[model samples]
Target: MPSIKRKVLVLIALLVVAFIAGIIFSPFLRETTYQLKNWVGKPSPLPPVSKTVILYFSTPKGELLSPVERKIPVKKEINDEIRMVIGELIKGPKTRSLFPTVPPETKIRAVYTKGDTIYVDFSPSIVKNHPGGTSGELITIYSIVNTLLENFPSYSKVQILVGGETINTLAGHIDIRGPFKKNPEMIEQSKILNR
Candidate 1:
């Protein structure tokens, strides 16, 4: 009967040790288990890390603009997303037939949203390096306005600034002192292709 009592005590002690070990190791076990599950092809609950956006770039003819698809990292805020899209636009199009309206060397200084207007500021290169002409200025200005308004419906107008100051015009043609709306007429109807 004493031996039987000792065996029972040993079993209870083993159980108590196991309980304490489980308490100590539970978090580690859970983390490891989750990693293992992910390694085995379990999909994570997080949203997609990137998304596709359409950017408008001028065709080589400079008479009209066309859509160029770009894949960029997803941003939490709309303004940040717009900045990313604009940055991509500044990078120019991958297709040889298309040309960049904004100067290739132009840098995006800032982008912000207020009410229904989105203000985009560019470095002095935008104005200084731009090919000054009526058609050139129209293409550059409309390309930005159309790209922003088409992709982001929430914004109705876009205001352009050069080196943080409001520019009277981009190239002595179009008045850029105020916000501009999307001008679909500037876009080639036949060239509107989506990817």
Candidate 2:
């Protein structure tokens, strides 16, 4: 027995409620929204530019090596070059370890640069008895890259080798060949580990 105007009002109210529910719970709407956000496009280029990029490979034994190269400064961004990064990075302890399991004889002997490659030679003790894990491996990897990239700021890629040979594996898990871009994600992890 509702009046015509009252029925029309009731119908409008039901439609509005249904629309609100769809907005809150519809899966199709959610998928469309996320897809739009991801369409934002590629990563913007680094402003400061980068000098050398490190390449990481994994061996079943968990050993790491970085064979660096210097560029001719053709289209390079930072002027410091990879040698500066090596000098600075090597000057530090080289190992940002909290466990104290690393051997004392383990040391980085020299950092050499030629053209677009930088070579870092370390004492044999470095790979002597080091244990391996994802955290440890990435920490070591980022330690070198973060230090070098901070100094050179150009190049854009790196190749890592052991005693002058590029190994294919880190702890028999990760592949460390080709070119590896510096990982910004490591910055936060470094801070946490430092503290």
Best by lDDT: 1
Give the clashing residue pairs of candidate 1, or none. Answer: none
Q: Summarize candidate 1's per-residue lDDT along 1-195 as a digit string, tens digits.
A: 999999999999999999999999999999999999888996659998998787888877899998877789999998799989999888888878888888989988899999999999999999999999999999999989998998899889999999999989988988999999999898877644443
Query: Per-residue CA lDDT of candidate 2, range 33-85, in tens?
Result: 88887897678886554334432222123333332232223244233344444
Error of 1 at 73 (Å): 0.4
What stretches of model 2 exceed 4 Å from their correct place?
1-104, 114-117, 189-195
lDDT over C-alpha atoms for residue 19 of model 1: 100
Candidate that scores best on TM-score: 1
lDDT of 2: 0.49
Looking at model 1, residue 39 earns an lDDT score of: 88
Residue 46 in candidate 1, Cα distance off native in Å: 2.2
C-alpha lDDT values of all predictions: 0.89, 0.49
- Candidate 1 segments whose C-alpha is farther than 4 A from its true place: 1-44, 191-195
What is the clash count for each candidate, in the order shown? 0, 27
